[model samples]
Target chain A: MSRLFVAMGLVLLVGASLSIGVADLWAADIDAGLVMAVSRVPRTVAAVLAGAGLALAGVVVQLSVQNRLVEPSLTGTPEAAMLGLLGITLFAPGSALLVKMGVAAAAALVGTTGFFVLATRVPQRDPILLPLVGLIYGGILGAATLWLAWATDLVQYLGTWTSGEFSGVLRGRYEVLWLIAGLAGLLWLVADRITLLSLGESHARSLGLDYRATRLLGLVIVSLVVAAVVVTVGTLPFVGLVVPNIVSRLRGDNLRTNLPFIAGLGGALILAADVLGRVVRYPYEIPAGTVFSVFGAAAFLWLLNAPRRPAHG
Target chain B: MTFETCNLSITRDGVPVLEGIDLSLPPGGITAIIGPNGAGKSTLLHAMAGLLSPHAGAVRLNGRDLSGIQPGERARSLALLTQDQGVTARLTVADLIAFGRWPHHQGRPGHEDRAAVADAIETFDLGPLAARTLDALSGGQRQRAFVAMAYAQTTPWILLDEPLSALDPRYAHDIMRRLHDLSRTGPDARSVVIVVHDLGVTARFADRVIGLKDGKLFGAGETGDLMTSDWLTRLYDTPMEVAEVGGRKIPFAA
Candidate 1:
């Protein structure tokens, strides 16, 4: 399918999903402007930001690690963010939103760095080994979060983070996710430097690129992106993993050229998932994260079993 | 301009890979660094490119310390190609070659960059495979494209680490010939410092030779003076023979 047409379709779907909700939002009796301003617009914006951020994060992880199978969620960034959020929410319950986000982002940076270090140690690039290690690493972090939550009886608060559901998103609550847009812009600025990352450290250094600095910058961006998404609308599993893969397959790995398409497709996929969640159970919405997982897991399975293409590597 | 190493020493994991290395490599023709495995050949190349910082001493480019030069400036002066040029991303050969211009244009490629890329493709005979992804090509073809990338850098100095290590004699000789021509032809001729394994190619193509063994310089001089069987055997710690062929010398392990 043509990218332009697909893009147009996504924009249309986003528009349609906003106007057509469970409550007849456009009905004459209803305050359509208020409805759009308060609930619909915020939800749509949050979904797009979270999706785009995760997708960009995924590309960064894959590039920095030089492995396509890894993503921010797999690298324990989101789980670590959850732990940070849980701690802040329990201990400093009255903390400002920014404080909470800052704490979460710091934890995320540390966790992602840990994953990056671990990736370097396991030099066997067996394709599957790295991602599996990441999955296990993330699982351990997640278990820690779960155990801590259980001990503190704060497991209920963890609900919003485990699965992304934009139903709760409203005007002032979702503004922090705008930071993802800013971070994405930052990533676009350094896309070429980040692309050098996939070529390996020694090679990048040989090219006059500051290999350590660029890699650190990429990790910082990935951590902040994952933190913003997780703290806001919760963990949107596989959005990063799946969106960037599809975009790279369709386009290529030239980060500068493909950043927009990746952002667009990421936005489209999550918005579509949200729309599907809404319509699949009218008057009762499934979380966008849940909806995406079903599709994402299937796509991942297909990707794994698919006949390997010579041109891919 | 001349590239020189002055008492350079480098260590890896508390053990030295290169120690007290000093040599002057004059710009113009091919210079081959030949040694048995684990002789700090790659380490020396990396340090010259400033990819590795020495534990002590310095590398001077035209009498200026390499450490003092910025990485960006260093890159514009010389382009280094490593032995294992493994790329995970699905990049077309054109994209890969164009990346050589990253230091010059830095993402926003200009007409000159494009022209250099085209010239490199033509020079390396990669026109047929330009659009193809690196994974789609055979090992030799892929290597040719990699060499083209280093050429497209348009730097005055080119440092290649065993680019022809895995190729057949035909492919090896083919690359050597192109590199030989490149170093000799244009006004903006590039000086090449290659970590070469094939002794015959080195004797034929290299104007200067630097022999290394056990993290130290074994010998350094004009190719004629360095290619003797006595120096060659001592360098490798094995018997070697040099035979005259077509009015040129070819050394082989005996």
Candidate 2:
């Protein structure tokens, strides 16, 4: 059934993508079409990769912590990456893109590690409080980024970086996102270990799984994906949180089997949203992140209200 | 394979929970650990299962120090069902049981893994509920499903922490009987160690009984010898009587 949904989604994506480039739609007008198509290709590819990476990261985080509400955004990773980007634009104004990505990746990694430390210190019995604490931590980091960007007279630049738009994702600037696909593959290789860890530390250890190591590895992977996506495009909210849950509802929570579908569906969802943004106002495009936020907020609310099954170990 | 503890001491939150506990469990029979509320029965089970690192002393599995063995290897030797089996997602009965094979097959299950899962389903009479999600089942059925997961682990030792807490009498009896039957048959016969509150069921079904009181071992011997009224009365600090009913020993408060 989910496969059917995905198939329909694919068709919708192709139609939307083609229609968005319809001004140069004819194949015979090769030069004009190539110029338009070539320009859109990198942004489209970056948006899809970001969507897929964020969604996969969200799945890993949710499963590892055994919590539904957590994602790379909620965990303060994107906030930290934003701060890193802000620092680069402020202090090292002439740094190369690779240097900027490095700073952002380091900041994201630190944020993820901080989350792990907080999780260990907080009582495991009360899990709902964990994400709340994480959100507040993220908010603080986001405030710091805002202050820095404003002080440096780069507030508008920071605004564009934080709203999660694919407009800045041009041909040369978007190649960094391919690294996320590699991270997704690595995540797949350890999918079984992550699933076992989801059974909780004690159960996983009893089964001969190195609970702490696997957990840290998962966090590192999440951080890498978040850093890559945030550096390429801004923070796309709830893709990680919503896509995994929707996929799990249709397919069981077996990470190995569901990962590819999660990636495909994630790419499709973000691409469709990006295309929708293009067509919604025609010449002037609404941000894909804004469209995702509206839809994602509704989906998130539905998930919260839906009758849920009791947890098992 | 044998399981034994040597002068084990455990502390939680700066307070000593279990003190100097020592016991040796032989293979292939059901052993019941019975005690009052704060007798540290759960602590003892956790220590034996390697869930908790004892403050002092050690646990030995089949003559090797449990601390020396790798966690994965330890998992293959023993399966522990903790007190609260809280799962956050909706998983089917077969999915839950397949978790048992995690130690053996990790996430990629093989043909033998599926066969073991099937055998576990058949053993626990969960054939009808194979496709049913765990949240959809009753408390008793859920308890049975958890036990089936442990059974699917196919280990030499199975440690259960108060599995009967939320179960009704019939389901409780059914689970105990199933464990009893499984211990006798199967390729690697399991040594079942259960923390039980009901004295009647423990007295009736258990081959051996270990009594604990106030973080200390009160008695360890055959059920027939240790389940007398005087022993139980002293153990719980309440007047009780033990009587034989329908070829099974039962305990009641006087």
Candidate 3:
């Protein structure tokens, strides 16, 4: 029943996303069909893909570390990707976009792996500590990225990448995000193994799961999603954390059952936020990252204070 | 088919936890591995279940070396319930039990998997609480659910590490009774090996006992013959006595 509401809400959000843009499709002088094909559709698809990818990445990180508070933003994934981009741009000025994304994905994997290692030492008794560490860790990486960008006089590029916005998305540029669709399919195929991962290593192995291999697979998927999103739409914080958490609360942690809802809700909410970003400024844009930050911050506080559910780990 | 550990020795951080230990377990009965704190009882149990790689020697199940066996095959042969397997997710009793059939079905659960889970739920009397998440259940109930999950694996061997810890006498006794019944000599009987801290419970339930002290095998024999006051006294390095009341041996510190 609730799923029907979600579906309807998603359809409405998609319609809104398609209809609203700066070009004013109804204007007689404008090439409405060309504008819709080139900008509106691609922008809408970018929002959906980036939001869904982040949400799935968040699930992977949270489950891998056995903590609920973690997301790609907190884990330094976006920062690491930005750092990698900066390095590649400095070394190879004319590198292709795909090559840049590949380097960024590798760096994100390393950064996330570092956090996973740090998570082991952090006590699991307190659910809040892991995310706090991740925040500091990401802050450090963000500082490093900023320092590199400043030294290289690439702060302008950094600004665009750090603040997620879909204004620049067009038919040709935003297509890299299509990779998230394939990754989501992969997540569905291994949904049960991922769920087993929520069970601690001992029990998971006892149930015949190759715990290390499965966790590595999850990490790789998370890195790829974060890189793809970072490359296409910049870093959108809290979409992954907030969406998966809401779905988990509503539907439980059965990833096989919750994947579609998580992905759909994430995509819809982010697209809705993007549409609001367009309408609120009226011919200007607030940047979906900025608009969603306002709402994501409030939701995050509510999630923290909301009477405690079962603490992961 | 027999389960045996041949010259099994485990070293963690260059310190031996179980050294040059060996014993073939008798089939079709409850065997309790008991020792004082840090006696490496749990370590031995984990090694036997193929969870740990021995620094020397091997654990063999049905004439196959456990180290050489694939994890899926190993899971089908034995189900291990380790202490403090954290409930990180809000998994319901039914969801957790269904995971036991993972080795057989991998991800796609068939009718046999469903039937096994149903059988396990019925066996553990968890039908009422099947829908409730693990955190919602009491300690005793949660422990029962975990045991049921291991049971649902339908393995020939079940290894448990200190399952009765923190439970009151009644819950502990109830769990032991269920295991004892399932472990009785029969075609379907499972071989049960548990790392136990309670001597009283061990005395009342365990058919055979393996005693470990300071990472060495202190003794291993039939419970009736080896659970004497003198044997336990030496094993624990404390004065101990066994009182037989109503045909049941009860061990206590003197």
Candidate 4:
């Protein structure tokens, strides 16, 4: 099923790349459109990479927390990154993209660390409470970003950064997303330890696995991926939450086996969503994040309502 | 190899649960820890398995202090099946059993790990259910699958805490019988320690019995020596009698 989606995504991406050049729809020349599409290959690739990265980050967060509701956005990492981007734009106007990305990454790391500390401090009476705490944390950070954006009269800039669009993800602007691939590779290498830790702390310790170290490593990977994706393409909602749950349904919960499949499906899902956003509005384009929000929310509801299987490990 | 606890005490949240627990078990047979509710049987088992830390004294494996050893090394030496073990995701029977070899191979599983997994599947009669997901199995089957995972760990010492809780009589007997057979026939042999409520089954299947009353050791000896009416009465604080039926000891009371 994911393979079918990938093929469809590729076709849509190619079509959108061609449509970017043909100013007049009726008088479109096939050869000119092909040339334009070929030239924009790099940008399209960047978008795909960013989508895949964010999706993979989502997978890692969901698995680590053992809750489908968790994503980097839900945990306040993206909101924190947005605040950092806002800070850089306001204080150090005309800063390099690298500087902006660094600030965002640092903010994301601190936000993630804060989330973990809060989560650990709360007694484990109900698993559902962790994600609720995360949602509240993310909301607070988002409100802070909103206040900063309004104060600086850069609310438009913040809107573009948070809207989940691909129009600005061209050439040099999108290169930062490649870092997510590196994070994905790191996750694969530590997949075994991560899966063991998911069985709960006591069980992991009983197996002689270093639970705390493994959990910290997973959090770091999640932070890096979340920051990179946010800085590249803004905040894409529900892609991470939806893709991992779908992958786990088709594949088993073994992280080693599911990581690649999750990455592929995540990339494919995001690309397809991006393409649909372009066509749904015809000459104008809706942001992929908006499209994903509508679909991702429905998928989330389905997962929540689905009959829970006894083997929920 | 034997496990010994010397003056062991455990406190949770500054409340003492087990105090001055001194006990030893010789290698190679089934040992049952029989106790009334709240006698700290489960706490003792958890401490022995290194899942809980003792506030004072120590638990030793083959005379080496258990706390001094690393968790991985201890895991290789002992396998524990805690009461109410849970798996919160959809995992196949085979996948669940493969977790047993996590300590042996870490992340990279080899042929030996695969063989051990297969051996566990066959040993627990899970061959037919190997491909089935745990959500699809009956409670009895799921219980057996978990036991198989512990079996695949292949440690010399196996500790179970209330393994038969909520299990029907037939499934309970079946599990006990399997444990009994494994203790007797395994190549390296194994010492099985179980916390059980059914005194009749304990008297019939256990080679040795340790009885606890109100967080203290009431008796510890061979099953025959420990199954007297007076011992049973005092231990449970109820009128109790022991009778032989079909050449098997049965414990009963009003």
Candidate 5:
């Protein structure tokens, strides 16, 4: 039932995304197929891919740390990726796109690992403290990244990539987003292991899981996902954090059962946001990141204040 | 077959928790490890289950060195349930129990794995609540679900740390009764070792007792010998008494 609704909604969102762009496909002067192939399709695909990637990344990080509030955006991942991109742009301005993404991913891994170290030190009595710590950590890294960009006179380049809009995505340019599809597939294979991670270290180890190795694997996947999203479409805040929480609340946290819904809802929600951004101002557009930020902040607050069901109930 | 620890000592950050403890447990009975708070009962149980490496000596399962076995193989040999199991609010009874079979199937559970899960569910009488999430259940129900998960592993030995710490008498007795039956029934009965806090429940259900005091082994013998008023009083460093009613010895503070 819910799956059917989600699928139908996805189809409708895709159609709206394809038709609502500035180029009126119905006009006789326009080559509808070419425009659809080159721009609209890539933009829609990028939105779905980035959204799904972020959501999956969020699930892994949440399970790995055994905390629901933290996500890649909170963990300095995007800031670190931006720093790597900045460094690469300064040293080898003409580096290939793949090389840039590789450097960004490596840097993201280091930044996320640093956050995990800090996370262990922070007392976990209050559920909200971890994300607060992560937020402050990410902010500091973001400040450093901004300072570097300003010093290097590449603030404009940083601004353009980091805003997370799909306006510039085209047929060949957005191909990197397909890596998410492969990563999603990999996640499916390891879905059960990731679920076991939520049992905490002792229980997971008792169940024969290599806790450290599995956590490292999850961290690597999160870093790659964050890097890919940041490299291709800047930062999509709250997609990772918001989508998984809503799905887990409605359903449950069994990753094997909930992975598809999380990925689908994430993709659908972001694509819907993109479509809304396109249609809201007609010929002009808002970045999906900006549009999602408005909705995501509202959702975050609701989730924060929402009364948790009584454990006895 | 017997489980033996030879000169086992565990130190956490250079502070010894269990020091040079040597004991051998005979197979196929409920062996209750009891002591005062921070007496390293849980640490001894963890060391036996291979969670903590001994600083001075070794733990042996039958004849093989416990730490020499691979983690997957060790899980198949024995199952351990810690007191603090962390967050399980999102998992259903069935889902949580099915994780017990992870050692056998890794990620790809087959027909036998499913059968084992079903067996555990039935054994623990959790059929109606199998689909219910952990948060919806009471404390006793959640504890049963975790024990069932450990049971689903189908190992020969099961070790639990404080399985009945916060439970009321009824729930505590209910769990103990089930564990008692599990440790004594059929040809494939499991050897159950538990770090228990309630001396009354331990006396009623445990066939044998291992007493620890100040991180040292104080006594090891049959429950009949170990659960006497004087023995327990000495072990816990407080006055205690035992009364016999209907062929059962019940311990209480004097």
Candidate 6:
């Protein structure tokens, strides 16, 4: 599709998303303008930022690993974030949100680095082995997080980050998510190098890219992006996995050309999930995480079964 | 433009691959590195191109240590196409060739870069297949495109490791002829070093031959002086003979 058409579709989704809510701006008792300014705008932007960030993270992971099956969180980013969150909640008990996010980011870096090392060890055949390893690795971190939460009586707080929902997103609470914009901009600068990485280690290095440094940088970027999303709106499972795959399948894996599409479609998919969640039971809302995974899981299955087109050697 | 290695000893995890490998290569001709398996021919090629750092001694370009050269400058000095040509991603032949211009342009390709890419496409006769992804092409076609990529780099030294190992006779000869022309033509001619199993091509096209045995330099000299039956048999540790066909000496094991 044309860029303009995609832009128009995005604008339409933004408009519809802004308008579809239980509390009407047209209601006499409610100040429509105030409601729109504070709640709707933050929630919508959160969805877009989270979506864009996760999908961008997805492409980075896939390209670096050279495996389509892997995504950001599979490498234990969210579970690591939970571990960070639980640790902070236990020790400080009243740490600032940004400080907590900082801790989460650190743990995420370690977790991601571990996954990267594991990925290098796993031979690149079947491709499914890497993700399965990541899933089990993430599960180990998850078990640790729950054990820590159970011990410290912080299970309820863990619940909040486990289920991704935008209902709690409001003014002044979600400004940290704006960092996604900066991260995305940072990604744009290194997009070309990242694409070269998919050419494999020796090939990219022979072309003068500092291959190890570039791979480490990509994983760090994935860690930071995943940390931000997990901290802001809990975990959205397949936005990172499904969106990039769709964009790559539809277009190609050239990061420069496909990044915007990946980011845009990611935003659109998340917003659609949020809208679907809100409207499905009317006043009673479902978590966007729950909604997307149900559909995202099916999409993942479809992606897995989709006959790989490229006759790769 | 002399390429030389000084007492270069390369070790992987304390196990030596190449030891006391002191040698200098004359510029502006095709040089072939011929050896048995595990003779470290590929390692020497990569080290000469500054892709591998020697555990001892140095690879020098005109007396300057290659290890001290910045990666971008090193890349501009020499282009190395490794033994494995398997690229996981499918990029078009034109785009893949354009990547050789990466060190020059980084991300921004200029007029010169465009001209070089076009020149490579024409020189390799990849015009018909330029728009097609490497995955869609036959093995020989893909190999040609890859060689064209290395050619487009405009480097003085072009190092290839077993580039024609998997090709049929026609494709093999086709590539050898093109590379022979590239290494000998004009003021901008490049020095080509290839790890080759095909002694026929080596004997016909190579100006100098470097023989490797058990990770050390066995012999290095002009093709005519070093490609004799005695040296060939000693280098391979097997009985061998050089047969003359149309005045070309082709070596064969007895």
Off by over 4 Å in 4: A1-39, A84-103, A113-130, A148-154, A311-313, B212-218, B232-244
- Model 5: per-residue lDDT, tens digit, A28-106? 9999999999999999999999989999999889888888888899999999989999999999989988889999999
Q: Arrange candidates by TM-score, descending.
A: 3, 5, 1, 6, 2, 4
Give the per-residue lDDT digits (tens) of candidate 2, residues A100-191: 88888888888877876776676656656778878998998889888887788888877767788776666788898999889988988998
Q: After superposition, how far is residue A31 of candidate 2 from its true place, in Å?
A: 2.6
Task: Look at candidate 2 and tell me the lDDT of residue B46.
Answer: 88
Q: lDDT per residue, candidate 3, A1-313, as tens digits? A: 8799889988898899899877778899999899889999999999999988899989878877888888999988899999998899899979988999999999999998898889889999888999999999999999999999999899998998899999999999988899999999999999889988988888889888999999999999999999988888899999988998898777778888889998898888889899999999889898999999998999999999984554222
Q: Candidate 5: which stretches are off by over 4 Å?
A: none
**Model 1 agreement with the true structure over A1-313: per-residue lDDT tens digits:** 5569668967897887787687787578989888889999999988888888899999999999998888898899999999999989989999988889999999999999999999988775478898899999999999999999999999988888898988988998989999999999999999999988988887888889998899999989988888888888889989888888887777668898889888888888898899899889888999999999999999888777872455321
- With candidate 4 superimposed using the best TM-score fit, by how many Å does residue A22's alpha carbon deviate from the native? 6.0
Candidate structures ordered by lDDT, highest first: 3, 5, 1, 6, 2, 4
DockQ of 4: 0.37
TM-scores, all candidates, are 0.96, 0.93, 0.97, 0.88, 0.97, 0.95
Better-scoring candidate (lDDT), 4 or 5 = 5
Give the clashing pairs for model 1.
Answer: none
Q: After superposition, how far is residue B6 of candidate 5 from its true place, in Å?
A: 0.9
Measured by TM-score, how close is model 2 to the native structure? Answer: 0.93
TM-score value, chain A, candidate 2: 0.91
lDDT of each: 0.89, 0.84, 0.90, 0.80, 0.89, 0.88
* Candidate 2 residue spans exceeding 4 A from truth: A22-37, A88-91, A117-130, A310-313
Q: Which lDDT tens digits does candidate 5 get at residues B45-81?
A: 9899888889989999997889998999999999999
Q: Is candidate 4 or candidate 6 better by TM-score?
A: 6
Query: Candidate 4 or 5, higher DockQ?
Result: 5
Docking class of 3: medium
